[model samples]
Target: MIDEKGILFVLSGPSGVGKGTVRKSLFDRATDLKYSISMTTRSIREGEKEGTDYFYKTKQEFEDLIKKNRLLEYAEYVGNYYGTPRDYVEETLDHGKDVFLEIEVQGALQVKENFPQGVFIFLFPPSLEELKNRIINRGTESEELVKNRLIAAKTEIEMMDAYDYVVVNDEIETAVQKIQSIVQSEHCKRERVAKQYKKALEADFS
Candidate 1:
């Protein structure tokens, strides 16, 4: 049978919504999938390695890429430019490997416009109260920043309908299973099924 087409899986959610956790779980289940590392002009955090955690670049280098149209989608977030490089994603897809990208709402929209075939998944908190608690529990930001993030989270949650699938992360394992199921089901689409059947019929006739 012919191999299924590669898929671009776009995952997005608000801060403290367990996106990273769910993504790691999904990767563990789907071994062949690859996560696309994004590029940013923001300073690298401690212990972050270039080309692994993120493609760290200077502001001037980032601007040069924008001028050359090398990025798939880019946006300035809190004074730093963050974007996905077009080449790496395209290259991965060409080799029939699924590419997973974790991006913000704006970047996700831009990717949808540019790559209409991409599958968009939005992770949602179980409840607004629970979401607020998750942010507070992290203790990574000041109270003021937490408040701002909560506001942003609400806005992002409201935009869930824009995605193709919505998975509520009440439990980590359940959420990961939902994402895995979505990816597996997509591979069995009618188009892919028909292609396989056609090849089988031709082989038999010949």
Candidate 2:
């Protein structure tokens, strides 16, 4: 395997940008990429499993992990704390399995600070008005909450430059294909190929 490291693909976008739908479609058509499950202090919602949805932790426990620096990135959203565990990500990459992290912009930025080698992807809506409509159409949050989210979306969009690739989720299938292409192309990068060449040369001379 030439000690090739797996890609850490972190996905981020504003709320109502259809990131979930696009991520699902992308994974369905791809292989070998594992999802990086996060831990949270939020109450388990209906039908949410402890391990599957999130590693549920109490506020104190979550704080302890933060103090110990065991979390790769942590963010408090709407009173609930969510964080990616450092150990899990490290182990997955050590196994040469790509890990996909679909998170909010705050958490994504934090991840970028800790792991600059990660491939950061940002999902966007076609337009601001379109993003508003998408959120309203969902019928999940109250009117006030929706308004707040729209404001937050603007802020998130401004930070798009932090990401390496921007995917517009106007068409789910098309967005998925674009991200798939990015992943495939990243695998062929010179940094990775050079390592394999070095390993082969060493083996031949040994």
lDDT of all predictions, in order shown? 0.86, 0.89
lDDT of 2 by residue, 1-206 (tens): 56667899988899899888888877787478889989999999999998788899999999999999889799898999989988888899999888899888988999998888999999989998899999999987898998999999999999899999998888988888888888889988987788788788999999
- Structural similarity to truth (TM-score) of each candidate: 0.83, 0.86
Off by over 4 Å in 1: 42-51, 56-61, 77-80, 140-147
Each model's number of backbone clashes? 0, 0
What does candidate 2 score on TM? 0.86
RMSD vs true structure, all candidates: 2.8, 2.6
Per-residue CA lDDT of model 1 for 149-200, tens digit only, reads 9999888888877899998999999998888888889887886578787988
What is the Cα-based lDDT of residue 189 in candidate 2? 91
Best by TM-score: 2
